[model samples]
Target chain A: MERVPILKIGDILLVSIQVDMSDQTAVQLQEDLAERIVATGCHGVIIDITALDIVDSFVGRMLSTIASISKVLDAETVVVGMRPAVAITLVELGLSLNGIRTALNVERGMELIAAHTDEREFAFDDEPDTETTASS
Target chain B: MERVPILKIGDILLVSIQVDMSDQTAVQLQEDLAERIVATGCHGVIIDITALDIVDSFVGRMLSTIASISKVLDAETVVVGMRPAVAITLVELGLSLNGIRTALNVERGMELIAAHTDEREFAFDDEPDTETTASS
Candidate 1:
């Protein structure tokens, strides 16, 4: 079975799905990601699907499952680089893949994750950032 | 103090901000929204910001805070009708409004919420929709 490669960039885990995903492969990727998130303590997971030419209901559910798993483990998942056709197909199929966050590209995915992490920190500490306060 | 009105449409709550939001007004809106969500048991919130011509970091944070509060109360928040210039200003201010979901208009926002609500029901029930399964 072919396995997806997960790359770690700083505190984010990046996974680019370049191959056609089988049921077994998708399950493997899910397991691998959960482990990677725990071992690396990464707060973000970016799934790049630019290379994927198509997606079906099964694939949509797989993405949603991975996202739910990551959320349970205290990590945010951002699906990026979805082709227009794939998006249209998903909508037509009635698989919204809800509870999943998406971005236009990996850069925006990182930005979203970074902003989320900042918000989490802001919630814990009542003090505003010195730079922002000074500017205001 | 100007109070934002939350209208209940179906199972969704809609809030359109047309007046200038002061600090106290923003806080009041937040409190009122939380109360409405609980009282009405609405599963979705649509915040229409189309009337506001400009937005600052404080408004950005208020939006974020409301989204977070809605999430905690088991409701989804979709911000709609944000203008282009407002989006640019938000980015310039370094306020990403990260966790809040956005849509182009009220219709799209409602669609997003509906899709999300469908996904939740799908999650709890393993059986796929009869229509979709039959068609597939």
Candidate 2:
């Protein structure tokens, strides 16, 4: 249980973590992840937490901070696999991660990344071909 | 254009890839990640997609599959960083990732892991020594 698994595929990384409602370990984990993210040069981060049944303001705030910090590092972040119950809990608890980005599941998250990548590439490709010469 | 920049944290590999939505790319990434997770023996997988603006049934299915694959490889996956707009879009689209795990952000994702770790540690630590048995 002391192990946190994170997998990197291309530019994206996958992470899975467990949680309990009545403890401070969640806070510690947040700080540890923030530090790890800053240390690693991954372009994107995904957090999957389907195990959590309830979330409070403190948990919500930590998540917001992590997202903010990830952005500061120039990496995009997404949340996936949210249960309706947890979503309702968060809303009822008056905890909202307004600016944080999230997806329903991992596939959507990947699509987001693909969209961004495609956009960037399209933008670059659309630039006039400086090396190509056309016969007038 | 194929890179999924989920979150960029200065350097560390926070949760990178979660679910793959790009037809072939998604499958490839999922396979690659499964292999890596099995080889490296990591415990948590975070899939963040703050960039996705849409979620379709295909993507939802893919996400669930990835979660299952990750679990088989002995790694837990947590989808993190969901956006409200996207969530609403998914609901409107009638897409659901019913059996997947998720977190709101990296902080919660990490907290989830930490809490699990603490639970195990406490469970073991709280065990009374046979020589010094105490009544609760």
Candidate 3:
């Protein structure tokens, strides 16, 4: 089975799905990504889908699954470079892609993840209960 | 102190900020929103900023804080009706508003939150381990 390549750039893991994703390929990618995130301790994951000409419900579910997995591992996932047709098709298919963050391109995805990481770190450095701060 | 009025429409809570958000007002709004969320058990919050002409760093932070509070209470926050100028200014001021969802208008915001709420409920109805389902 063909496997998706995962690249590490800075503190972010970059995965560009250039090949048609078979079910087995998607499963392998998830396992590989989980391990990569733990080994590298990366705080960001950017999935570039620009090369994908078609995205069916299965692919949409895979993206959402990847995002949820990364979230559980304390990493943010951003799906970038979705073609317009793919987006339309996902909408038509009623796959809302809930809980997944998206960006127009890879650069913006990096920026989004970086900004979020900084904000989360800053929040941590402050009082543990942010609600108290707001109340005060 | 001027208070922001929160209206309940169906299963969603809507708050339209027409006046300037003073520190005290912001604090009060947060308290009110938290209480309302608990009392009403609403799963979605739509904050309409259509009337506001300016959004400074403080306002930006207030929005993020509100979103966090809502999330903790098991509700989703969607800020809608952000004027173009306000968006540009927010970008210039470097307030990324991380974790807070946005929509072009209140109608779209409602749809976004509705879709997400349904997805969550559906996920709950299925196997709790969604990751397992995806892998299979």
Candidate 4:
């Protein structure tokens, strides 16, 4: 039972699925990723699936579930590096994986998360950074 | 100068781009759809692109633009029937079509819009329908 490695880069969690997924493995990964999100306090999760050539319904569902659950845990999820063949197969299987964000690769995924994080940070800075001690 | 056709089904507007899109067509479709959204006062929009084998940056941008504009017009948009190759190319081109809703086909697209429409309708219903509300 090999576990998918989740690397933490700043406030982001990077998950690269380099092996084929069994139904059980997909389920286990979902649970593990959720737990990791809670433990790491990561604000973003990027799943790199460049090596995967196929995405069955089970795996597609798992990806969608991971994304929605991560959001509930206060993190955004980006699925990256989905090959054309895999994407084609998934679409043909009638699984659009709706509501899940995606990117071309891990680099774009990181940029996407970083942009989101920056936006959130600015959300709390309604009072501009016009610093002037006390009564300047 | 060819224009994409938009048909109305109930309260949903259906636009199926059946031809290969030139950049101008993509731009024009966006404008036409935004105008139609305002005119029809529709609750939902479904875009069918199953006939397309490729999705370039311009087309991808149009899809996103249509979704956002529809949102601003109080209509929800769902892009349906994206071919696998198109999706794969989109991901590779770094166009994730962010913030756009998608479904596998026209049937599912309708269901997605219907679900959204129903939710909004029930939003004003203070009490839940325990009796199934006209079960007869």
Highest TM-score against the true fold, candidate: 3
What local lDDT does model 2 show for residue A69?
A: 75
Tens digit of per-residue lDDT, candidate 4, span B31-80: 98888888879988988775567788777887888888888888888888
* Candidate 4 similarity to native, TM-score: 0.45
Question: What tens digits encode model 3's per-residue C-alpha lDDT throughout B1-136?
Answer: 5656565656787776756788999999999999999999999998877667889888899999999999889899999878899999988988899889999876688788888877776777886677334322
Instruction: Please provide the root mean square deviation of candidate 2 (C-alpha atoms, Å).
Output: 19.9
Q: Rank the candidates by lDDT, best first.
A: 3, 1, 4, 2
Compared with the true structure, all predictions reach lDDT values of 0.81, 0.60, 0.82, 0.75
Q: What's the residue-level lDDT of A70 in candidate 3?
A: 95
Two-chain DockQ for each candidate model: 0.01, 0.03, 0.01, 0.01
Error of 3 at B6 (Å): 0.6
Worst 10 residues of 1 chain A by lDDT: A127-136
What proportion of the true contacts does each candidate reproduce?
0.00, 0.00, 0.00, 0.00
Q: What is the TM-score of chain B alone in each candidate?
A: 0.89, 0.70, 0.92, 0.84
TM-score of chain A of 2: 0.72
- Ten residues in sequence with the least summed lDDT for candidate 2 chain B: B4-13
Error of 2 at B52 (Å): 33
* lDDT measured at residue B64 in model 2 versus the true structure, 0 to 100: 83
